[model samples]
Target chain A: MEATVKIFRFNPETDQKPHFETYTMPVESTDRVLDLLEYIKGNFDGTLSFRRSCAHGICGSDAMRINGRNYLACKALVKDVGLKIKVEPVLGLKVIKDLIVDMDPFFEHFRSVMPYFVNDEPPPAKERLQTIEERERFDDTTKCILCACCTTSCPSFWANQEYLGPAAMVNAHRFIFDSRDRAAAERLRILNDQFGVFRCHTIFNCTIACPREIEITQAIGELKNAISTGALE
Target chain B: MMQTRVVPQRGFNLDYIMFIFTRVSGLSIVLLALVGIILAMVMGARTQMDLGTLMRWTFFPNPNHVVNSDIPDVTLGWANAYWSTMQFLLIFFAFTHAANGLRMIVEDYVNRGVGQLLVRGFFFLLWLFMLITAIFVVLSS
Candidate 1:
């Protein structure tokens, strides 16, 4: 089947404004959207640029708006998005070039959440351990690839870029709920600010837009629950 | 693993206050509406008032408030008996009703990149305007 891929193009140095350039090419039903992008870049226009590390969707370097929804290009197949495809850079971020967004703000929010283990205690004789149930408590949030898909799709983030976004909260949730981590209090303090979990508004766009299918809204609700009730359960 | 049973409590902030306020306000609204409906029913609304009058009574309960004199000598109406309750109800409930309803619609339809920032800014100002105006009206009256 022939697929028409319209790519959002912009170069700050050259183009006065952003525009879309369309390419028609043959594609199989099983071919990934990344394949279509590669075809366009390889044959149609070498100047076209997009981020993609592992074409298998693990790297999460190619998250974009495909057909008005956030999805990983390498994960979305041609048949799923139909023949006529419209691709654009993810929303709520500064676009550097064609299909490339500045992810500094996103990473900054992630870092602010302290998305790491912080158990300041005498080193256990050997290593710390966790129960299966405790691990399962926050298992869902462990799959975040830092794609910014969920964060970019959030309307709250679009409205207020400082809202920390869903991806950061999910990363926070991962460590906050961990029975092995002791920084939950500090993280909760940060999240209690104006740009924290309270800004979520329960929109659920982050949950739907997540390519990994992580229950982003549920994780946020859990974070809110922990803050409100002061109980991790 | 660290002893992680309960996390820290949330500190005070407008957002946190409003977060809890939103939940409590929702329940208060239902309770207030129930009180209004029951009082209206008990006040012989079934026998004397039509469904429209009962609904108006349930909502504002001050059927003649719109036309009532600002400097009336004495409170003289079925709703006047419950004046204080109706006063508090009319102030906060109405504000939350309209503001939260608008928030729901805006959050539902105008989500994502399109019109998000514009709608959010517009709603915030509208809420602030409504709050200040309501306070002024209450204080002046």
Candidate 2:
């Protein structure tokens, strides 16, 4: 199949404004959008830049706006996006180059949630034990790969980066509902600030844009419920 | 399946409080409208007034709205202190609910710094002014 791909281009050192560069190439129906990018970068312009590690969607590095929606380039099939595909960097973040965005602020918000486990008591003989039901309470949010797809697609996060976006809330839900963690209240306090979980308008954009199929809006709702009713079960 | 792992409850800030208040006040406004309709029908509105008059009283519940309608007398049923209180309550809920909603929208963009302060101050005064004027009209008329 013949595909016309328009990839956003930017070079801070060379150009004052960002622009788009189109590539017309023949690709198989099974060829993914990432394959098109790789082909373009190899044969067309060597200066094009993007981030892709593992190329299998596990690393969450190839997230970008594909046809106005957030998706992993490796996972987006050329056949699914039709003959014409428009790819750009994710929204609401600074594009350092073509498709590579500055991810430091995103990671900063993720780290603010205290994503690690916090149990101050002495260790058990082997590992912390948990029931199946307890594990299922937060099983959905554990699939988040910090891809920023959900956060960048959120209107609230786009308006204000200070607000703790949906990704951070999902990470908070993971630990806050764990049966072995003891710092749920501390994490709740951190999220109870002005720019916390309440910032979410429950528009479901984050839920729809998640490539891992994580129930991000529902996770944020659970955080709001926990903050209001103080219930983990 | 219960609050086995409980989050410590603390006094929530204005945002969470307003989030819950928006829901409660929204329901309260609906209930108030229903109450107004019931009272209007009970006082012979169904027989004595048209649909426009009945609908007008359903929201405002004032004598001025019904005075020029098919209803002959407006001294006792629709023009008393009780109806004035209802009008005040309706305006209060609707205004406060909408004002807080405006703040929620503003918080989406301006959560910090001078812009936040300016929007907060400006919208608050606007809400206050509108509310006071509504209250005066409700009581005087």
Give the top-scoring candidate (DockQ).
2
TM-score of chain B of each: 0.58, 0.83
| Model 2, span B1-141: residue lDDT tens | 423766765458987888888888899899999999998888877776779988888888877777444445654657778889889888888889988878877876665779988998899999999889988888888
Native contacts recovered by candidate 1, as a share? Answer: 0.69
Residues A1-233 of candidate 1: C-alpha lDDT, one tens digit per residue: 79999989999999999999999999899999999999888898998889999888688999999999999999999989999999999999999999999999999999999999998788788889788889899999999999999999998888768789999999999999998889998999999887798888898999998888999999999988888888988
- Candidate 2 per-residue C-alpha lDDT over A126-177 given as tens digits, one digit per residue, 9 for 90 to 100: 9887778888888998999998999999988888888889999999999999
The TM-score between candidate 1 and the true structure equals 0.84
In model 1 chain A, which range of ten residues has the least summed lDDT?
A: A154-163
Considering only N, C-alpha and C atoms within 3 Å, which residue pairs clash in candidate 2?
none
